[model samples]
Target: MTQVNKALTAFQVPIIDVTTDEAIFEGEGWDAVVVIATSLAEIKQDEVSLLAAHASQIDFRVGKSATLLFAPGLAGGRLIISPVTDSDNEYSDVRIFAKAAREGIAIAKAAGATKPLLVVPSVTDNRFANAEQVAALACGQELWQPLEARESKSLQPSLTAIGLLNTATHSLLLNAAESGRVLARDLCGTEPERMSAIGFAQYCVDAFADSGLAVSVVDQVEQLKAQYPLLSAVGRSSFDVARHHPRVVKLEYVGEGPITKTLFFAGKGVVYDTGGADIKVAGSMAGMSRDKGGAAAVAGLMKALSILKPKGIKVIAELGLVRNSIGSDAFVTDEIITSHAGVRVRIGNTDAEGRLVLADLLSHLRLQAQTAVNPQLFSVATLTGHVVRAYGGYPALVENSAAKKQGVAATLAEVGQLWGEPFEVSRLRPEDFDKIADKNGAADVVSSNNGPSSITARGHQYPAAFLIKASGLTETELAFTHIDIAGSAVEGDPLYGKPTASPLVALLQFSN
Candidate 1:
């Protein structure tokens, strides 16, 4: 692999190490210079004296809102002056500054500059450092340009901190950027086959083979069918050896000594959803390749855990890898399929295949928790369009424990604020399950209801309710939370809708 490929696959950000002693305009020239200021007045002073020298040559003005100024810097280099705060606030928030810095990088890239210098005028506090680091990472992401057949170049840029730059803060920025790069690549890639169920599983195995992670693969249809009928049922349609078979990938991260608490993470890995036998319309299935976003997120979280390696907590990530394709043997609606939990499920809509796969895997996790100590189960998936309609790019969080709901909500909010991955808390009412019970009177559970309307109208609560029941988790034994990232899985844009790879930072923060 080339250097660019290595940097991308290994999740390393393109950053060049630098010392504080280096002059801003010395040695090799830079393509652009990013100047961060609080106000235009601040820029006229000694804080940005370097840029102030050429302020008259280039029209520079300050405003109430964050703005960017483009001009010529020393030695024909471009200068980008970005303000983080307006007149109302003294210091801009980390997010605001980070965004401004990102915009600065975008402007520089648009102006045909590859090597840009980032200069923050603020005192290096925790907030300032965070914003600066986020800016650096965002800049690196903007610089990264990948191609399928041709060799790509690495995005290596130098960062200079005017004030004291802590070593720990720098390291944190580098780590976060690396993780973000992994997520961006997965979300932004255009290749569908590379992210297929089997293909993804192999990728995971390759990623963690030497990372001290115990990886297991279950690909044979018969073997999966014998163990997890629901998972096998959803994946049985595309069983061709040449076309890529359905599979389940399990990653276990056991800390030192006996496991005291087990955190189970199950993700829906429907590589491409043709809605099975139900068959989705043209536009509905346009980005169906992103169906495996849930699994991708789980994989991203696993990658973070491998590096962080928090002590005492054992993490098990189960990815339900499958392709919900339509074929002669595809599982259809109204079929009575028995789940691994032994609950008889009458499929109401084959389109609701994510829940079916998650149901079996969650049930298996519940069974494993029986012997484990302090087990907590958390499942992530883009299970419903209703969630997307309701939350619109923010994950919908549903937890079984009503009492701990507030705490969970606060934690999620904190993580969101810290990392920009926000989620809303949604309730799972009893009536949701009652409707499912009414539909499948003969069976223990109904995979879905009469139509998409019933599922969407209820805000996708039915699936969560069914999953709880299928997982064999009693209301009283509340230790589970379901994150519905249906709407939030991939960012909607005119170009390819990129996967957000959300809640990865949240999980990492919570684990720590």
Candidate 2:
């Protein structure tokens, strides 16, 4: 293993604050000091000021509770964190754990602490006291925040539950989130060759199996063509690196139980968008490599679901993975590409390839919703600049129904500043869709006129909103909201206050 891994493995963790006396002591291989936050010692008056008083300090608080674990001589450093909850407490929706997890994790990451200690405040049982390193830990679901696009596990006496925020448990969750993030970053930030469609698909499949979820992948282009025509069309015209083999990747994660809900998650997996034959200016395409951030988000979310095994929730995330490279074999302008929904799209601009990829994926969701599950599903993607511009670095909204609108608003509110303000809803119908609906042609409105319109607040953002509705979703209460993360998905976001993937926050907000 690596050096960091070795150090964490060897390090002894201490869990304090368990007794009525509240004493400071050193045990064999572990040292600790327990203070009573519920008693006289609790930092009550001007607690934030008191914690800030210490030169080299560490302090944390959730709601009315406040805690400080500090040392005078440690100098300046970073903080690492862990989140813990109990099995019985998992369904409670208590504020303490979630608040603690989000706050603790953020502080730890921001401080750059080598190892974080999320001391779950509990008295019944000890989960992390003996757990070892992993992503995150849950005792009774006190604070079970799943960044599915970024999920978790436990450490200390590894695999056990944590009723209290145990140091070792926090370490494990910290490790897991960090490791998962690296994997996610690798999937997006690195060269596509290393994280190919097949390799990535296999990893996701393995994760599902390990977590007791059934996984299925359709890698052969012929199979994908037969079942998912839209995926094939967008991909058949594209190539993956050194091979001419037509690209097509499909994945499904099946959870246990009666499958109460089938949450259809789709992503625009354009591995690399070279603007095709139309090409793109260097400045306008600096980070085109991150075109696959949507897919990465989907992959990360799938990984988390597999690992956590959140019961009673059935989810299927679909990704349209392909590289829109510039070549003679490429599907250029003036090509009418039929969607999985069977709607014909005249390619407007190859730079607008994100739309084509999304068209197929959205069509798939529409087909599934129209044919199968009860019409209760949500589809997310890094689809448009219009949504991003409308939301403008805050939580934007484009709800198709009252349920989604209320659920999303309430969930975000509970997180307490975790997500930004949402954008207003923009309608998508056959009339508006037909106006800019050509595959071989660029949506002139989006290309030529982008400003505050009958729709969003400001900017040229028509393509995604217009075409997404064209998929099988009906004109009635069958709601649909398209998220265009043209400038939204990233590690460093000014509004979120740290390097983040945005989807996690969106998921939490949506779940509420």
Candidate 3:
């Protein structure tokens, strides 16, 4: 057996270990300089202005694409200018800077520069307050390679460190967030075998060791089956295989100051979703490993919280990690099962397993919220294809009545837009509850419609209804939100794309 390499459990992305400098040319030992701006003419820095002036005279692409120019006077005899487009419009937000910064960093890496200084022009506009930080994070996003690629190829970090020019002291925060995102990408984008349920739990345990967050992993078959019946049902077929058994990782963070807000998160960590008895056909299961993205993001969020140690807030997360494998013991459709909350649920479709896993976890969180301070509940999952059909590359938030009244989704959507992770606010209506109603009247609710969520009407929206009912929070006053990241968890190809760590940044910013 090839010895497995242990993952770097901390902030290991060297490129994101950022530094801030007031000037671009002062001998910070930077190899190359990459300037990202909406309008080059507005920048007041003398050295950047001189480089842009010279570059504009020689190449027309200076302010258009990532244009690299040779200069003898600059830090590394090279200058890369990237432009942010359409940032002045009503719909445009701070992501323009991120997009341009990614392009600039890519060009710098391709140019063989190990230490590039990023010059992001800070804007006074309220909308772009965090533009500099967003751009820096974008560079991290662009430079990050997949965990498998790094482990198999024995890849080393290409860029040593990044310098942030004319920006606030955000290195600590940016590095923390990027570190969380890196952990998220690694967990969400890895192969099923590498990130099996037990493996995932072990990773979290190792990552959070001595981080001050109380972490516990529950792997006992009897304990899991009793505490998380719905989640256990999804993993029943895989239980016989010791390496494939399910796990529930519980994480809690308490700030030093008096608690002002309490947050409870339930993450659906389906390590591999073969779709159970209702299996996905025609290569649909190729990227089923990414089904654990929600749990991965939550784990990453806890990591950031542990590092930052923000005050006055308490966070608790339960990640239900399981593999929806198929076998004689696999739970099938039409089977009636009682949830942890004591609500009877009929398996409308075995493929709709994420919600079942989340329902039980959410039920547990709901119980914790009863005594929490100003509590808010959220269940995150890549649960349905209907979200992708509805909003391409954007996560959707479905809030119950209590959360809607509190503008929970609206606030998250606003924060997400500015941080390069956008969200679409979806409403839960009477029709949604109706859709999940068990027609047979044999159970309290149905997991999902038998048809594909991409074709079913209100497919993504109705799952929140089932979650609310099955979790025993149907008429509760607690603020509860159901986040469906089916569309935004991965970028590009559905099977082989990079995990974007959707809503992590948004949720992090909103929590702050």
Model 1 Cα displacement at 503 (Å)? 2.5
Candidate 2 Cα deviation (angstroms), residue 182: 5.2
Candidate number achieving the greatest lDDT relative to the actual structure = 3
Residue-wise C-alpha lDDT for candidate 3, range 1-512, written one tens digit per residue: 11221355322555443444443553658888888888788666787787788778878788877888886667787788889989779788888899999899999989998888888877787888888888988888888788888878878777888878753477778877877888888889988998999989888887788789999999899999999999999999998899999999999999998999999999989999999999999988888999999999999898888888899999999999999999999999999999999999999999999999999999999999989999999999998999999998788999999998899999999898878888899898899999988887999899988999999998899999999999999757999999999888888888879887777888888887
The C-alpha stretches of model 3 lying farther than 4 A from their native spots are: 1-6, 9-11, 14-23
Cα lDDT over the full model 2:
0.44
Q: Write the residue-wise lDDT of candidate 2 on 429-491 in tens digits.
A: 444444564433442222212222324333323554544444545444444555555455653
Query: lDDT for model 1, on a 0 to 1 scale?
Result: 0.66
- Which candidate gets the maximum TM-score versus the true structure? 3
* Clashes in predicted model 2: 63
When 1 and 3 are scored with lDDT, the better candidate is 3
Ten residues in sequence with the least summed lDDT for candidate 3: 1-10
lDDT per model, in order?
Answer: 0.66, 0.44, 0.87
Number of colliding residue pairs in each model: 0, 63, 0
TM-score of each model, in listed order: 0.83, 0.63, 0.96
Which whole-number lDDT from 0 to 100 does residue 200 have in model 1? Answer: 74
Better of 1 and 2 by lDDT: 1
